[model samples]
Target: MTTIEIDHTSRWFGNVVAVNDVSMTVGPGVTGLLGPNGAGKSTLINMMAGFLAPSTGKVTLDGKQIWRNEAVYRAIGIVPEREGMYDFLTGREFVVANAELHGLDAAAAGRALATVEMEYAQDRKIATYSKGMRQRVKMASALVHDPSVLLLDEPFNGMDPRQRMQLMELLRRMGAEGRTVLFSSHILEEVEQLASHIEVVVAGRHAASGDFRRIRRLMTDRPHRYTVRSSDDRALAAALIADPSTAGIEVDTTEGALLIQAVDFGRFTALLPQVARAHGIRLLTVSPSDESLESVFSYLVAA
Candidate 1:
């Protein structure tokens, strides 16, 4: 099985650091590169795909250097996030071109197109294809050489539910065949549903790695922030502050709510209702204020 190793890799463009000191090993399996947009997921993927060189450190495939090495292309297949395609070319023609680059023929391209289920519309111009269809064609091009390592950046960006399902199943089969498959995605549910292991990136830093369930537990255990609006805001705030679970509470006059920081999730959840009932405070609105993926990633990075 093929394996890609990123050893303390860092990539910077001028003054901006795109990928910080990040190190991770991608082996033969489905691995999800989970991160929010602009968190350097694409930069790291480009390095793995041998499209970009790291400013520091190295990216390797099976201990062999990947950058500027043409030989690695035989084992590496990439479906980039960019939309740079030959619009006039038909799906088959495009995949055939990719095959020719690897000393392959039309037969290989046909097989690739068939694998992606794009043979039905193989004769159509790429300009007429939907985003999902384009993604599948790009995937076909990547598979034309029958690569051992596949790197996809946001492969499900424009795919519908059915298209997503089909692609997921295809990737699962490839991983089962012992292919090293790594796909970047910002959606948590998408990653959870597809990958056996996940590597998380937050602001160009490697935050967490390993089983999705354990990483999810770390995310859940992080301090939670909430906005609570009640009939008796002052009384509720006073009651909540007396408990060790409530770290702090700030009265937001503009929003007519109390912004709360809860340290112990379980304790705070159980205490809230009891405190509210005791104070005769009817809870009008109780909403988690920092439930975004970015917030969760930031917490993980800090931890």
Candidate 2:
């Protein structure tokens, strides 16, 4: 398996800079390209798949340029976000066409179809397939050549949990075989569950790149605000403020609750309950105030 490298790359469209000075190496393993919507993940994937060229620097696979290099397709397989596969062709025929493009025969198509478990409906035209079915068919096309490097863009979109799990298992296996697998996603849990390493992009800029847990810890270190209502609000706030983990605690007059800003998320979570128990305060509600994905993503972008 070969590693893909992006060195000082930047892409732009007239006034819009899609990817700005982002460089990273993706090697053998399942890597999650994490980003919010409109974060240029798609643009980066396209460049890696040789679908687009950067305005500056280079994208290479084992030191060979990827852009406009037809030979690179022999080593790379791509599943793009756009759903423009041959709809008139049957599932089997579609895969057969893909195999034929790789100079293989119908048997190669059948094997790829079987791997994705789409043989049952392989005879049906792709026009009748649902989004998830189309996804599996697209996956079959990418796998038909058994390429070492696989690039997928939002591969889990519109998939059910079972379908999602199946795809995840397949990717994990490919990664174990030393194939470089990179997929883009906006969801945190998908990346957290499937990838040990992650690269985060924000506002068309490379934000963070490394282990998922390390990036996660950086996010978790941000203040975690929560709203809590207890039997004795003042007493609970007093006890919570005594701990260094609690950055700031405010007693809301109209809301009749405590607004807590926790600098240390993990420590504060544990500290809050313990403080309540020890102070003999009964908690009526303990809801996280800033648990939305947008907030988490914005924080990463800001950082």
Candidate 3:
């Protein structure tokens, strides 16, 4: 099986460091490059795609160096997040152009378009296509070479529900066939449903790497912050503060809510309603304040 190895790699743009010293192995199977926006995911993907060179260490395909290597293109295919395309060309023409670059013909392009379910709209100009359609056509262009390794950066960004599922199934099948597939995504649910393994980056740092469930557990176990509104905010805060599960609670006078920090997630969740009932305080609104993927990633980085 094909494997991509990143060894202590780092990339810098003048004074700004994009990717920090990070090392990870992407073997045959679907691996998710997970992180919020501006977490160096695109920088890492560009390095892996041989479009950018690492400033410090190495990025290799199997045993060969990927940077400035022309031969690696035969084994690698990339679906970039950027929307640059031949606007005047039809979908079929765009894919065929990519195919010809690999010394292939229209037959290969036709098969790729079919694989991405874009044959019906192949005659339409790319400028006339929707964002989702353009994304699929770019995927077709990438697949036209039938490479053993596929690298997709935010592949589901513009896809609708059905298009998302179709691409997920295609990646899964490719991985099942022992082709190395790596796609970057910020959405937790997308990664949870599509990737067999996940590599998480935060603030240009490699924060975690493992199965989705394991990563999910880490996120779940972290200290969670929540906002709670009750009929008696002060009374609810006083009761919740007495519990060991709650790390801290601050009554926000402006919002008329209690900002709670729970160190023990399970215990705090179980104790909240019980405490509210015992104190005769009616809970009105309970919501997690830091539920964004960005916050989750930040928590992992802190851990």
lDDT of each: 0.95, 0.93, 0.93
TM-score of each: 0.87, 0.93, 0.91
Q: Which runs of model 1 end up more than 4 angstroms from their true locations? A: 230-254, 263-284
Q: What stretches of model 3 exceed 4 Å from their correct place?
A: 234-245, 253-255, 266-282
Query: Which residue runs of candidate 2 sit more than 4 Å off their true CA positions?
Result: 273-285, 301-303
Model 2 earns a TM-score of: 0.93
Number of backbone-clashing residue pairs for each candidate, in the order shown: 0, 0, 0
lDDT, candidate 1, 1-303, per-residue tens: 899999999999999999999999999999999999999999999999888999999999999999999999999999989988898999989999999999999999999999999999999999999999999999999999999999999999989999999999999999999999999999999999999999999899998999999987788778899999999899999999999999999999998999999988889999999999987889999999999988888888888
Q: In model 2, where is the ten-residue run with the lowest total lDDT?
A: 293-302
lDDT of 2 by residue, 1-303 (tens): 699999999999899999999999999999999988988999999999999999998999999999999999999989989999989999999999999999999999999999899999999999999988999999999999999999999999989999999999989998998999999999989999999899999888999999999999888988889999999999999899998999898999999999999999989888888988998999999999988877887888777
lDDT of 1: 0.95
Candidate 1: residue 90 lDDT (0-100): 97
Q: Which candidate tops TM-score?
A: 2
Colliding pairs, model 3: none
